[model samples]
Target: ADSLSCVRILRKMRERVSESISKMKADMSRAEEQARREYERERRHEYDSAAYLISMNKQSAEKSKAALPHLLTMSDHLGVDLLHLSGSALSTVFDMKEMSSLKS
Candidate 1:
C-alpha cells in the first residue's frame, strides 16, 4: 500500500511538472509574438518615412525643373536689356557733351 501511494505521488508530481512546462512554453510563444509585432510596426514606420522623403524630393525636383525655362527667359530679358540700356545711355550722354563743346 505504501509503495502504491508513492507511485501515485510521483505521477502527480510529473503531471504538475508537465503543466508547468506547458505554461512556460505558452509564455515564451506569447513573448515571441509580441516581439514580432513590434518589429513589424517599426519596420512599417521606417518604410513610410522613407517613402515620404522620396516623394517630397521628387516634388521638389519637379518644381525646380518647371521653373528652369522661366528663370532663363527672365534672366535673358532683364539682365541683357538692362546692360544694353545702360551702355546706350552713357553713349548718349557723351555725345551730348561733345555737341555742347562744339557749339561753344
Candidate 2:
C-alpha cells in the first residue's frame, strides 16, 4: 500500500511538472510573437515616415518648378542678384533635371 501511494504521488508530480513545462513554453512563444509584432510595427512606421517625406519632397519640387519662372522675373525686375543669395537658400531650389537624376 505504501509503494502504491508513492507511485500515485510520483505520477501526480510528473503530471504537474509536464503541465508547468507546457505553460512555460507557451508563455515563451507568446513573448517571441509579441516581440516579432513589435519589430514589424517599428519597421512599418519607418517606411511610412520615409514615404511621407518623399511625397513632401515631390510636392515641394513641383511648387518650385511652377514658381521658378515668376521668381526669376521678379528678381530681375527688382535688381536682386540671386547668385548673391545664401548657399542655404539656393540649396532649397531644385532644378528639374537635377531632381530627375536624384529619383534614380
Best by lDDT: 2
Q: What is the TM-score of each candidate against the true structure?
A: 0.32, 0.34
* Model 2 RMSD vs true structure: 32.2
RMSD of each: 43.5, 32.2
Return the clash pairs for model 1, or none.
none
Give the distance in Å from residue 35's predicted Cα in candidate 1 to where it truly belongs: 37
Query: What's the TM for model 1?
Result: 0.32
Model 1, span 1-104: residue lDDT tens: 99888667645543444443344335434544554565565566466766555554443344334333433343363343312233234223222121121100
Worst 10 residues of 1 by lDDT: 95-104
- Candidate 2: lDDT of 63? 38
Q: How high is the lDDT of residue 86 in model 2? A: 40
1-104 in candidate 2: lDDT tens per residue? 99888667645543444443344335434544554565565566466766555555554444344434434454464455544444344333321222222211
